[model samples]
Target: MASVGITPLSAIDWGAPWLEPWRVLGEPLAQRVTATAEPVHAVLQSAVGARLPVGFAPQSELPAGTAYEQHIWDTGRVPTRDNLHDFFNGLVWSQFPQTKRRLNQLQAQALATQGVRAARGPLRDALTVFDENGALLSAPAPLWHALRARDWQRLFVTLRPLWAQAHLILFGHALLEKLVYPRKPMVAHVLQAQNAINKIATWEGWLCAAMEADAWADKPFAPLPVLGVPGWWPANADPGFYADAQVFRPLRATQADARR
Candidate 1:
């Protein structure tokens, strides 16, 4: 796959605070897209296609019963990069298109077997949420298991170093909406890491780092909203937020290294 230049997102003001997730893509691509005055579909297609030759087509063109991700690739009908929601979706496609495709496949499978009901299985519900607005999280397997079990201590404190290995790829519109309100029990894809030392400068770079770690390749990642992470959101401004050792355990004074 070719490499698209992904820049840092430090200087750009994405207008709304919730749109902050775009920073994960770094600056290059984000800044370029925001600065460009052309149609976003063209810009996103050019950027995504520059790296992966496959382009998106209209959803109407796709065959009936096509998997979600395949439809996205086959019909590029994702949110355009022009607005906030679509922009993030477009960025996700550029960074983690394969994983996105896999998510679509799983969502389709779940729908096929279970169909739509008022109450869906945990896995199916999780798949739907992620399909719409979930983040792809790649980390160590232990970390993934810890997240799956909601073992906050292990995930945020004991296994802190593993966090550097943890990568988040935001794709969910609902996830972003939830972020605006900010809530608990945020679920994400628990991807196992393939590399720990790779640097995250751009969305593509972050994707490369996670792909290099590909430890959880082809496996269905479980879900958890990582936004509830202790230091991840500003809502944790309350000292009491971290005081809940059960969910947000406190790190040792010496163990606490400032890095958010």
Candidate 2:
């Protein structure tokens, strides 16, 4: 029962492997949408209960001249819009409250010290990039080296068997939205997880504690064409799938030179 401008829950391919982790929370909320944020808020509240860090408010509730992150920090109310983007955002907040709160805290601190300028400082910029399109990759060392080097063939084929020891979790709301209609070129700014993790809650706790402004300012992310991850997309099973140079680009000569 989606309202105008909202994608129906039934329309989304919940069976998609990428969406499987979030289907539990997303499916029920999608069925409850009806032109307002209240239903979304209610579901979030019931799911997170007192543990919910912020309350969901209509987008119009946000005051003019207020920053989005600051508003969330000051009032603990997230101005939610009735769209797929915000829908996924709310789902992330519910799923990763600790990590979400840490990100907001960093954003608020930056706004307080730096004020809103034409350009967001490096830390804020990095935070936003990760917030909008970040992912976590827990894989073996060799796979990590190959990915960081942008060695697509080695990562996807040569060391393909190592994928059994890997798990990739999408953390960004926008990333989730884009995956609803997956495209081969869709990429994620990936941060490596230090240890093997089996549970989402464990990842959340680790990510929250790992948030560091100085470290993030350097933009330490590896670009990963998500679908290229083994078994995620059937088309990628073909040996020639990585042949698309445009998507599975090798490391730039300049970067390679620097590495040497």
Candidate 3:
């Protein structure tokens, strides 16, 4: 099989619902390809303002042997690449500075104690999962229950009206990058927000406080087919949409047993 290659800068639709939280910082930068790190860093600096916890530096700034997270923790700089993945990562850093820093701090701590072992212990593994593909969901209790239970029908159909009051924010940069070319099966590992957080600042703070090194070992994220969220994708409007068992999978017996 051949690779599709990276999506061009101009091809990204900034107005995408998943991209809404990042539009302010991402839209202007996506206007053209800044193939080098300096221009990308400059735009990020302008967009994020002085409060940005870390500066965006070229990937080369990272020494040959230093781990990525440790470098950021030591120097307060993120090694950025010239691609959509790192671009969205920068947007995330700008939008969720506190949470990003907390994640990095945890990662650095894990690296310090665990070193660069082949098997990143449970805590580090779970952190990587969330960092690469997590989302924050501020929906009603029923939605949360149905989602956690993997009850597709109840989540998207029975209690569908409740979605009007819900908010789903895509936090993971890789998740955001994948949506640049939307696909039905693209899932997000979601963490439900305990309170109704509307402002990005409040959300960031809440997320930072909520993240615990111990709790992360259990991997509390729930899998959600992002596009299936009502109003997120046009095709999902059809009642038959959730019938795709491959995407809206049923909870396995082992998983059900574990919940008991």
TM-score of predicted structure 1: 0.52
lDDT of each: 0.52, 0.86, 0.85
Ranking by lDDT: 2, 3, 1
lDDT of 1 by residue, 1-260 (tens): 01243322223354444355555453456566556544445666766666643454433445566544445544546524344444455666665666555555555555677775668566656556655655555577888767656566566667766766665645565565345445555555544334452332444445443432123233345555465554577665444453455444344455344211
Per-prediction CA RMSD (Å)? 9.9, 2.0, 2.8
What tens-digit string does per-residue lDDT give for candidate 2 at 1-260?
35767674456777888787788978877766643434555555566636788888778889999999999999998887767788789888988998999999999999999999889999999999999999998999999999989999999999999999998889999998888889999999999996688578989989999999989999889999999988899999997999999999999999889778
What's the TM-score of each model vs. the native?
A: 0.52, 0.93, 0.94
| Candidates by TM-score, descending order | 3, 2, 1
Q: How many residue pairs clash in each candidate?
A: 21, 0, 0
* Pairs clashing within candidate 2: none
- How high is the lDDT of residue 248 in model 1? 45
